[model samples]
Target: MKQHIRLLKTYLKPQRKRVVLLVLLLFGSIALDLLAPRQLSLFIDGAEAGASLDALVTVAVVFIVLTIAKQLVVAVAGYFSEDVGWRATNALRADLADHCLNLDISFHKDHTPGELMERVDGDVGVLSDFMSLFVFSVLGRALLAVGILGLVFSTDYRIGLLLLAYSLFVVLVLRRLQSVGVPHFNALRRTKADLSGFLEERLTSTEDIRANGARPYVMHRLSEHVENLVRRTRASMISARVFSSVLEISLAAATGGVFALGAWLLPGGSISLGEIFLIYYYTQLLSLSLIVITHHLDTLQKATGAIQRISELYHTTPQVRDGEGGSLPDGALDVTFDAVSFGYGEASRTLDEVSFALPAGETVGLLGRTGSGKTTLTRLLCRAYDVDAGAVRLADVDVRDLRLADLRDRIGVVTQDVQLFHASLRDNVTLFDATIDDGHIERAFAELGLSDWYASQPDGLDTVMVNGGETLSAGEAQLLALTRVMLRDPDIIVLDEASSRLDPGTERLIARATERLLKGRTGIVVAHRLATVRKVDHIVVLDDGEVCEAGPRERLEADPASRFSALIAGGTA
Candidate 1:
């Protein structure tokens, strides 16, 4: 409940004027609805008294005008309500997206992209009813109920007091049932998210699944998820049915009691015929008002479940927080790893007490077999994960003391697999940044010897890469990736097997581009090919998570007993 109230204030506070207008219009419409009952009672009394036809016509026409005005006000109020809901939820979606982006990479590892999408988009969609209906329509119904009782009191206080107690009883009962199905709905939502994640994972891996003859296995797993979804959905539906049945019983009993009392009072001239009719009519109106609330109550349970999930997401603070330190020094920056130790979750250490350094304007080649912490080293340098022990420093200043944005801005990373978005080549190169001019991109392609490749495109940078650049070959993607890094002109460059994807034909082109890229920057090359690391100033060899050897590349190559020399002789590096 507190979370619900907090969300309401956070979103509704921005649209103050629309909210006020909606409230006035809604209450005005309710006033007209309530007055119609009174007008009906007046008509009944006038007919009983044989009042003139002209007088009756005037009252009838007034009632028709009231009805029409009420509809117009309601239609306008609905527009405001929907507009407010869409605006609030869209803002919330943007906030959620930004928040998720800032969270630790580990958080993303636990949740699939599809699940996150559902949380940010689908769960918030459920709250549209809560935001639009709960904000004003719920209150309008309550006001309508009160007005019904007020008119009844003017007719007769006895019925007024009885109906008030009934209203309270219905409210209490319904409120209790509202929470009864929320737990089921929450579980149902989780099953839905899991289903989405499963589908997305399978769809993305379609080629691998088909090539390996694992389509049958995939379908079996999908079936299991679908079965789980059905079970949870069934449970939620049963709970809702129970809630609706109870509401129906309460309404039926209340209506019967009102009619019975009105009949008893009509005898012995205690209340006039028109008075009985007015009481009955208001009682029916009150029942209809409660029916509206009952409908909202059902949606409220679903929205409550959604709110619980969204609140949890908002409250989740990231482990990696921005530092309060000053900006890093300009120009090429030396990189340092001092007795660093780290692991993912409860797993054994990935980089254990490993240490190395690259002087400014120099390059170090990292030679390591598989699972030797080569990638983890680069990750630590980029501050993707903090060290469990010791520190990663730039220019001898601990990275933990630097702002994350500034730290990352000065370091560039190029990986074997490049992720391209479905956008124009220019947008992909500049990452949708309009600040970078076309000349800079063209220059980058030239520096990397990709000018011919760029020109081959039908429309140059304006050419849209279809489906995440699938049209580009593996070698072409690497060329584009190198050009992207060169454009950034970072102080430090980490190439994690960046050339592993290039064909033999593009090897020299990539090598020349890499040499140019590392000219004045501190560079760390995680290499599997000796030719890739042969030109580096220094070499660091790793076995397991520890650094086994470190020295000047020429000296290490000269020493046959060195680990770097042994790896080269064995054709491992």
Candidate 2:
């Protein structure tokens, strides 16, 4: 509870004036509520005393006005509470998203998108509702309870003692029930996240599932997951109901005592008719508070469970963090892998003491059999993953000692897989950065010798594209990726089988663009098809994660017995 309050303060602190206004409105509503009952007591007492009709009417009118004012204040408080809760939770969600984005590739690989979505969206939403309820549903009603008890004690000590015991018992019992309920609800939330992950995976692969005739299998598995969720949800509800049942039973017992005591004391005239009504009505008010608490108790437990999960996520420190903020030297940086060794989390080494170098402003082709660590080398160059041992140096500066942003800024990578968004062509080309001028985009296309292809678009750069480039061919998507790299004009660039998916005509266009892109830049061109190998100054061949051959491309190709010469003859690596 202390942690919950602390978190509320943290998020609510920025909107201090709104929160203050909300608190004032809540207190005003509670005061009106408390005052209304007092006015009712006065009206009854005045009527019983044979007072003038006008005096009784005035008291009744006052009670009506207080009731109306309470509702109005309550409505205003609701608005402010919701407004504050929404802003705070949205800020929390944004922070969580930014944190997740900074996490390394390994963290993303371990978590499903759907699971993350549930954490960011579902959990935060629960916290948002609970935040609002904590103010009015819990604290405001608590004050009302205290006020009711205080008035009762002033009138009669015995009744106040009875109701105080009732209140204390309810609190203690509900708290115990909450401790037992949290685990079940936590399990329920995890199951929901699992279901969401399963659904997201299946939905994304709908094409494969339908084409492979695996629909029945998918449906059967989905049914099993749905059934598990249903069972957990039922179990969770049953656990929650225990709190409600306890409160109802306790309320019935307390209400019986208040009625019995009121009747016994009424006959002796020890308590006036008006005073007796006040006690009964205030007892009813106490029961209402108990009901409100009972209803929100489940919410409290859900929020408690959400906070635990959110805390765990918040505390997760990323494996990849910024280095000592070292700066890189300007323009066409040389690349080096010095005795580098790496593996993916307990797997066998993918790159074992691999050593290589390329002079500044020179292009090299990386040749390898499948799983020979070609892609891994490029990833290390960009510091997507740090080396397990040894250093990846650019311009002779150790990459581990440089800030990731600074290192990556100078090295641009265009992979074979191009991901496009559902947005305008300019947005897609600029990756949603609107600051880039159209003139630069035109210059990039012209440099790539893609002006003719660019002009063929119905709306040129303003054309909206479908998500994942479904509206564009594979070759066109790759071209867009090249355009992105061209725009960046980094000191170092990597191309991963860039021309693999194109027709001969598109291949020529990409080859021309590839030549333009690699000009005046250090390049690591990965070629499985050997189409781009002829353009490189040097070649490095990896077999089983060790460099077996590396030399000047012209020298190696001239040797009939050399691996590069054989790979060129075979037309593949």
Candidate 3:
């Protein structure tokens, strides 16, 4: 409850002006609505006393005008309230996106993209509607209820007290019932995210599922998720319905009781007919307000659940902290890993006390079997994950002691699985960095042997890549990634099997590009093929997270007993 209130304050603080305006409008609307009941009573009593036609007509017009004005105020207030709600919710959405992006890769590995989307977007959408209702419907109706009760007491204190007692009773019952619904709503939210994640994962792998003939299995899992969501949703709905029904029944009984009391008192001259009618009218108005309040309460409960989930996300601390560190030294930076050790969570170390160094403007080849920590080593170099022990350094300064932006800005990474957005070729090549000029891009493409591919495009740099670069071949995507890296011109480059996905012809083109890219930059190549690393100055071989061989490639190749020689002989390099 405290967390929800804190979350509300944090998001709503920026919209105080709108909130105040909405409240003023609520007061005006409620005043107009309450005045209509009095006008009706005055009309009825004046008619009973044979009042003038002109006076009656005037009251009728005033009542109609009041009704229209009340609705207009409500409409204006609702619009502003909705505007404020969306602005605050969008702020929260942006914060969530930024937070998720800053979290460590391990955190991302534990969660699916669809689940995070549901939490960041879907949950906030629920809060938006609830916020609007809270500002307009809940507050406005609550004030109306209080105003009616006060007016009823001015007419007849005894009946007003009785109605107040019944209102409290109904509120207590509904509050208790709402407590039962909150947990169910929370569960329902989780189930919905699970369903979203399941569907997203399945849709993304549609080809694999179809080719493997696993449609039945996928459908069964989806059905199970749907069934779970339905059950929880039904439970929450049933609880809310019960609360609404009880409030309706109780309010109806109270109205009947008031009517009976008024009838009995009228004969004794304890109350006038107008007063009886006033009390009854106010009772009905109060009933409507109570119904609105009850409905808003249900919405509030669901929003509370969403707020708790969102707060949980906000409270998640990133394992990788951005240290207040200095910038890197200028020029090509030598890379060094001094007895580095790391792991994912409680798992065994992926890089166990590994140590190696490459001088500035030198190239090193990393040869390792699967799960031998080649990629992990590069990740550590980039500070994607801090070392569990020892240090990774650039130019003798620990990577952790360099500002994250500065460290990453000077290093470039190209992986086998390239990511291309659905955007224009210029945007894809620059990755939306407006500072990269078209001339630089054109030169990079030509230098990297991608000019022929570029010429084949009818729209040149304006051509749009669709469906995650489906229009381009795998090798083309890899080349595009390399072009982006070359444009950035980082001092250190990590090529993690960047040419592994290309055919022989494309591989030759990429190899020529790679050689040009590595000319003046320090390079670490995670080699999947021995031929790709033949000209590398140094070689490091890993077996079970330990460095088994480290030397010049020619020397390792010359020694028959060396791990690199054995790998080549076994055709495993």
The Cα local distance difference test for each model comes to: 0.85, 0.88, 0.87
lDDT of 3 by residue, 302-329 (tens): 8878989999998899877776886676
Give the clashing pairs for model 2: none
Put down candidate 1 lDDT per residue, 1-573, tens digits, no spaces.
687679768987998899889888887888888887667777888998999999888888888888899889888998998998889888888898999998888899999998998899989998886778874457788888888888788877888888988888877877777777888889999999999999998898888899999989999999999999999999988887777677778878877887787888887777777778888877777887777777777577788889889989987888887778866778999888999998986768788899888889999999888889999889888877889999988998888888888888898998988887788889888888899999999998887777888899988999887543357776677777788888888899999998775777777778888898888889999989888898999999988899999999999999989988888898778
- Residue 534 CA displacement from its true place in model 1, Å: 2.3
Cα deviation of 59, candidate 2, in Å: 2.1
TM-score, predicted candidate 3 vs. hidden true structure: 0.95
How displaced is residue 246 in candidate 3, in Å?
Answer: 1.6
Where is model 3 more than 4 Å wrong at Cα? 296-298, 434-437
Sort the candidates on lDDT, descending order: 2, 3, 1
What's each prediction's TM-score?
0.95, 0.95, 0.95
lDDT tens readout by residue for model 2, 168-229 = 99889988999999999999999999899999999988889999999999999999989999
What lDDT would candidate 1 get against the real structure?
0.85
Q: Which is better, 2 or 3, measured by lDDT?
A: 2
